[model samples]
Target chain A: MEGRLARIGLRIWVGGVLLFLFVPIAIICFYAFNSSNIQSWPIQGLSVKWFSVAWHDPQVRAAFVLSLKAGVFATAIALLLGSAAAFGVHRFRFFGREAVSLLLVLPLALPGIITGIALNSAFSFAGIGLSLLTIVIGHATFCIVVVYNNVIARLRRVSGSVYEASADLGAHGFFTFRTVTLPMLSTALISGALLAFALSFDEVIVTTFTAGAQNTLPLWIFGAIRLGQQLPEVNVVVVAVLLLTVIPVIIAVRLTGGGGITRGSAAARSAMDSGSPGA
Target chain B: MTSTVAQGGRPGGEPASSRHAGGVPGGGSARLAAALWRRAWLRATLTLTPPLAWFLVIYLASLVVMLVTAFWSVNPFTNTLVHTWTLSNFRQLFTSTYLIIIGRTVGMAALVTVTDAVLAFPFAYYMARLASNRGRQLLFTAVLLPLWASYIARVYAWIVILQKGGTLSWSFQKLGLGAVNIGYTNTAMWLVFSYIWLPFMIVPVYAALERIPDSLLEASGDLGAHNWRTLRSVLLPLALPGVVAGSIFTFSLTLGDFITPLLVGGANSNFIGNVIYSNLGTAGNLPFAAALAVVPIVIMVFYLLGARLLGAFESL
Candidate 1:
C-alpha cells in the first residue's frame, strides 16, 4: 500500500544516514595526509611526512607494543576461562547457573568506569601495582564474556547425541573430546579470540584506570588528543588503528560465516545488546 | 559386518556392563577420564571452578570492596583511607554542585537516548524490510565496522570538525553563513555521544524487525489498514522491545561516559564520570570517588530492571 514517492523518500533517508555515519571517518583519514600542521578545512598540500614522525616516536611505539602484548595475553586468558565456563553452563544443569550467566555478563553490562574504579581500589588494597598484568586482568574480565557467549551459543547448537555416540563406540571421553568437541568448537573459538583481541586492543576506559603510567595505543591517542599538538601524528596512528581493528573484525565476520557481528549468537546479541557501557 | 563387529568388541575385551562396574580397564589418565565421565558433579566442578573463581575473587570481590570503601572516609591530611565507617562521602553527593552534575548527566543521557532512537528507527526499518539480501549484508557490516574502530579516534574526528577554523566552520563560511565554531561546547558533546552510540541502537532494532514475518505486514495491509496504520498498530509495538533494548545502551553509555566531556565539553560540562575520575586520580579522594560512582550504578540497576520488564532482554 506504500506509494512510490514514500519508497523513494525512505531510500534517500537511508542514504543520508549512511553519509552521516561515514563522513567523519572519511574526514579523519583525509586529514592524516595534510602537509601543514594546521587542521583547517580544504587541503593545503598532501604529504606522508606524519608517517615517519609517528614511526619514530618512542612513546607511540611503546604504546603499540604494549597494546599488542596485552591483547594477546588477554585473548589467551579469555579463551581458556571463557570456554571452560561455557562448557560448565551448557553441558550440565547446576544450581546458580543463571546467576553464573548473569555474573559472567556483569563486567560487560555495567559501565566501564565502575569496573575500572572497582579494580583500582582492589589492586591498591591488595598491595598490587598497576602494570601490564593489571591491564590484562581488566581486559580479560570483559573479554571472558565475549568468548563465553560465543562458545556457549555454539555449544547449545551442537547435538548431545554426537557425544553419546562417541561414548557408545568405546571412545573414551578425552579422545572423543579431542576429536569431536574441539573440532566442533574450532570456528567459535577462533572468532571469539579474534573479537576478544580486537576489543582488548582498542579498549581505553578500563585501561585508563588499570594502566597506571603505561600507555596502550588508545591511551596514547587520548594523551595526544588532549595535548592538541600532535594532530597529524594522532591521525596517522588512528588510521593504523582503524586498519588494525578492521582486519580482525572482517576475519571474524568471515569466520562466523557472514551473519555479521551482531547476529553471531544470542549471547553475543545480549553482550552487544548491553552495549559498551564504558564507550 | 560380522568381522567389523567382532573387531570392535575385541578392543574392549569385556562386556560393557562389566566395564562400567570396574571403570574400564585402562591406564591412569584413561581411568581418571572414566571416573570424571561418570561423576556429574566432578565434571561441573572441573569445568566451572577456574572461571568462577576468577569472577568471584577478582571481579565480584572488587565490586564489594569498592562499595565498602564508599562508606569509609578518606583522611584529608594524611591522604589515607580512614577505616572508620561514615556516610560523609555520600552526604557530600547531596550538595548543590554534585546534584547539578548528576542532573546534567542523567538529562543528557535521556536526550541522547531519544535522539538515537529517532535517528535509528527509519534506517533500521529500511535495512530490515526494504534492502535486498546483498544490500542488507552490506548495511550490517557498515553498522558493525565503526563499533570496532577506536572510540578515541571517532571522538577526535568530531573535534576536528567542530573546532574553530575546522571543517564545519569552513562549510558554513562557504555557504555565506559566516564562520561557526561550536567546538568544545556541550552541543559538541551531545552530537558526538549520539553519533557514536547510533549503531548500538540500529543493530538490535534491525534484528527485532527482521524477526517479524512478512505475512504479518501483508495481513495488516489486507485488513483495510493503510501504511501508517500498519506501522503504528502492527510494526511499532512489535519493534518496541528492540527500541527499549537499544535505549539501554544509549542511555547507560551516556550516563557513564567521561571521555566525551573531557574531549569536547566546555568549562561547565563536568559529568559524574569526570568528577569521579578526577577524585580518584588528581584529588586522591578514593572514598568520595567510590561514593560518586554509586550513582550511575544505582541508576543502571533501575534502568536494567525497567528494561527487563519491557521484555528488552528477549529482543537482545
Candidate 2:
C-alpha cells in the first residue's frame, strides 16, 4: 500500500507540472477571444472580433509576411548547406572534422545574446545595413545545425551497400544520388526544414539585432508590449504564431518521436560512425 | 557482332553503344560524376566548402571581431569606434555596481536551475519508469507542445496571472487565503524563468532516467537496500549527468535571457543580457556592451567545460 500510494503521489505531481506548462498557453488562447481591450483576471467576455482586427492591422500583416519570407529563405539555405556538410562529414575522413562539428553546434549551444551581438557588431563593421537579408543570414547560421543533425542521423542508418549497388549497376553518382539517396533522406530533410522554419519564425533576439526599420512577428510583439498599445491584438498574433509553429512541431515529433535529432551522443555517435560501408 | 565486341579493336572499330557511352550529351554529366566519385578528397571538399565558409566567415569571424572591438573605445563626440585600444570598458565593468549585476544574474540563474531540477525530476522519473509507452508518448507531446507557443505570449500570460487582482489573487481570495500580488518583481522573474526553461530540463532528465537499467535497481533490492537507499546510491548517481545536463540549459538560458525579465521583472531585474542590449541599442556603446557580454561568455565557457567534465555532453 505504501508503494502504491507513492506511485499515486508521483502521478499527481506530473499532472500538476503538465498543468503549469499549459496554463499560460491556455491563457493566450483564451485572451485571443477576450472582448475587453484590457487584460484582467476574469476575461470580460468572449468574442472573435480581435482576429479580424489583427488581420486588418497593416503592421501585423507586414510583420507576418516578413517572418514567413525570412523563415523560408533561411530554411532553404540551411537545407542545401547543412545536408552537404552532413554528407561530407559522414562519407569521408577529413582533418578538422571534429572542429567542424563543434562549430556547427556552437550556435545552438551558446546563448543567443552572444550570437546577436556578434552578428550585429560584424554587420556594423562591414558597413552592411541591417535588413531582411541580414536577418536571413543570422537565422540560417543556427538553422544549419538543425538540418545537419537530422541528415547526419538519417545518413548513419542508410546502408553503404545501396550506394555501391547503384555504382555496380552502371549508374553514375548523380543518377545514383537522385534514385537512391534522395528518396532515403527525404523524411529527415522535410522534418529538419520544418523545424528550421519554426525556429526562424519565432526567433526574436537575433532578429532584434539583425533587423533595421522592420519587424518580424516576435519583434513586433516585443514593441507592442513595451509601448503597451493594442494589447489584445498582441494576443491574436500570438495565438496565430502559436498554431503555426505547433503544427510543424507536432509533425516533427511524430516523425522523430522523442529522440529529437539534436538530442545528444546518439546523433553524435552516428556522425562519428566512420566504419559504415558507405564511409 | 558478339565476337567483334569481345575482340580488341581500334577506336573506329568499337561498338556503336560503346562509342556513345563516352560521347553523348547525357554522358558529359555522367563523365563528370564518375570523375568526382573517383576522388573522395574532391567530393569532400566540394560538399564541405559552402557550410564551412559560412561558419568561418559569418559566425566565427564575427565573434572575433566583436571580441576585438571590446578592447577599443568609442569616440564620444561622434559615437564612432576609435581604433585605439583601451581597457576602460573592462575597468568600468569591474566596479561594484556591474559586479553586483553579474552576481545577481548568476544567483537568479542558479535559483531557477535548482527549482527546475526539483520540479522536472519527479515528472521525468514517473514518465520514464511508470508510464506505459502510449502514456509516455502523450506526455512527451504535452511537454513539447508548449515550446511552440510564442515565448512572449507565455511570459505575458504570467504577467496576467501575477498582476494585481489577477488569477492567483482572485483564487486566493475565493479560498479565504487573502490576496497576494507578486507582479513585476524578481520573484516573478524567477517563476517565469523556471517556466520557460522547464521543458529543456525535462527532456534531458527524462532521457537520462529512461536509460537507467532496471537490473541495477533490482540488484540493489536483492542486496536488501530500501527504496530510499537505492534512490540515493544507484538512481541519483546515474541521473547526475542528466541533471547536470539539464542544469546547463536552465542555467545558461537564464543567464543570457532578457525577454522574460523585461516582461515580468520590475525596475531592478536587469540581467547581463539586458545590460548588453541597452548599452548597444540605446547608448550606442558597442565596446561597453561587448565588454558586458564577455562576462556571460566567460561564465558559460567555464560552465560548459564543467558540464562536459560531468559527462553532460553525452546526455546533451
Candidate 3:
C-alpha cells in the first residue's frame, strides 16, 4: 500500500537524520587514534601514545583535577540543598512555596551567559579572586536544578499517607524521615548526582566567569582547539572525557527506569529493582 | 563515587536492634554509632552550606551591583568608578554602532530560530512518534552526544567543513552544484551556528512532541482530518510549551554566544558574548562590558515572557 511505502521512506529519513547528528562526531572520535596529526583522510596506523601525551600534558592534568574537585563538591552541594529544598517545598504546603519552587528552577531557564556575568561581577567586586572556590560556587548554582528536579519529582510521587503512617506509628520526626523517606528517595538522589557531576565537569560559560586563574578541562580544551594544540592529543582528551561521562550516563539511565510509574508499587520498589546492573 | 558508597553498615530491616542502638550510648559501640549519626547530619549540612552562601553572596548580590553600576559614572582618567550616578551607559548603548550590533544579533537569532524550527519539526517528529524505542534511544543519545563534546572542538570541526572543497563542498559538487563559497560570510556563520544549536532544539521538541496524546491525533484522523491538519490543530498546539521552551533556550543561547562567530565569522562580526569577552580581556572596560550584558538579559527576559504568554494562548 501507499501507506507502507510512506512509512518505509520515513524510516530511512529518520535514520539519515540520526546519522547526520552523530557521524561527524564518530569520525572525529575514530580519527583520534589515527596517526596523522592534521584532521584528514587516508587513515594511517593506530597508537595509544597520543592519549598518554594528553594525559601527561600539565594543563590537561591540572584542569582534570580542578574539574574533578569542582564536580564532586558541586554535586554534593546540589544533592543536599536539592533534597532538603525538595522535601521542604513538597511536604509542606506553605505560602509562596510554589513560587519558591519555580524560582529554584528558573536559573536553568536563563542562559548560562547571564548567570556567568552575574557571578563574575559579584565576585570581582567583593575582592573575591577567581579561584577553585569561585569555580565550584558558579557551577553549583545551575547544577541545583538537576538534583532539585529529580528529588521534587520523587518526593511528589511519595504520597502524604506514607509519611502520615510513620508519624501515626509513634516514630519521631528524624526516625520517620531517616528510616522511611530516605530509602525511597535514594535513587533519585544518585541519578541526580551523576547528572550534576557531568554538568559541572563540562561547564565552561560560567567557568569562564568564575575561574580567574584556574583552568577546568573544557577551558583548556577551548583555548587549544582554536589556538592549535596537538590535535591528536586534544582528540585523546575528548575521548577520555566522553568515556568518563558516558559510563555514569548509562548508569543514570539504568537507574532512571520510567519517568512516572506510580501505578501500583511505591517508588522505593523501583530503586531496589535496579540492583542488577544492566550495562 | 560508586566505590565510595559504603555497604552493609545497617540493613533496612532490624527495627528492634535499630531502636536499641539509637540514643542509648553505653560504650565504644555507642561512641562509634554516635559519631556515625553526627557525621551523617554534619556532612549533609556542610555539603549544602558553602554553595548556598555563594549563590546568595554572588548571584543575588551581583544583580544589585549591575543595577548600581548602571546608575554610576565611570572616571576614565582617574581609572576608578564613582558612585555619582548617570544614565550615559544606557544612553550610549542606543547609538548607531551599538544599536547595529543589537540589530544584527537579533536578526541572526531570528533567522537561526526559523530555520532550525523548520528542520527540527520533521526530525523530532520522527524520533518521538515513529522510531522504535531502541531507535529512539539511539536517536536521543545522538542528539545529546554533541553537548558532551567540547564546544570549541565542534566549532573547529566546522572550520574544516565550511572551507571550499571541504566535506560540505564535496557534497555540493556531487549534487551538480558549484562549490559552496560560504567562508567568512553570514551564510557560513549562520550554518555553523545552526549546526551547533540544532541539537538543543531537537531534544526539547522531541520531549514536547512525545507528550502529545496519541488518541487526539487518531481521533482527528478518524473524523476525516488528514495528517497535516491533524498535526496543525492537534499535535502542534499540544507541543507549544516544548517549542517555546526550545526556542527560548536556542535564541537566548545563540544570542549570547560569541564563540561560533569568533571562530568562523572572523573579525567583522561579533556577538554580545564576544563583546563581553573582549571587555574582560583586551578592552579592559569591565563596566561597559557589564553594562552591555544587561541589554541581552533584559531583552531575553522579555522574550521569554512573550513565549510564555504564547504558551498560555496555546493552552487555551
Best by lDDT: 1
Candidate 2 local lDDT, A1-279, one digit each (tens): 128888999999999999899987887789889998878878889999999999999999999999999999999999999999999899999778877887887776677888889998899889999899999999999899888887887787789999999978888888889999999888889878987898889888888889999999999998998788998999899888888778887787667553334322232233223221112
Clashes of each: 0, 0, 0
Q: Of the native A-B interface contacts, what share survives in model 3?
A: 0.19
In model 2, residue pairs whose N, Cα or C atoms come closer than 3 Å (at least 3 residues apart or on different chains), thus clashing, are: none
2 versus 3: better lDDT goes to: 2
TM-score of chain B of each: 0.90, 0.89, 0.80
Better of 2 and 3 by TM-score: 2
Better by TM-score, candidate 2 or 1: 1
TM-score of chain A for the candidates in order shown: 0.90, 0.90, 0.87
lDDT string, candidate 2, B1-316, tens digits: 1232223232223244344457323645655565566657657777887898899889999998889889988888888889788999999999999999999999999999999999998898988789886787688677767754566767877877888867888888989998788998999999999998888788777777777788889999999998889889998888888888778777887888878778888998878888888877535899888888788889988998998898876653
Which residue pairs show collisions in model 3?
none
- Best candidate according to DockQ: 1
Model 3: per-residue Cα lDDT over A1-279, one tens digit each: 115766787777677766665665665567568676766443467777787788888888998999999999989888877776666565555466555544555555555766777777677667688888888887878777677766766776668798679857765445666898889888888878887787788777778878976788878777776686776787777666766665555566567553311111112122223221121
- Sort candidate 2 into its docking category: acceptable
Query: What is the lDDT ranking, best to worst?
Result: 1, 2, 3
What does candidate 2 score on TM? 0.91
| DockQ scores for all predicted structures | 0.46, 0.44, 0.20
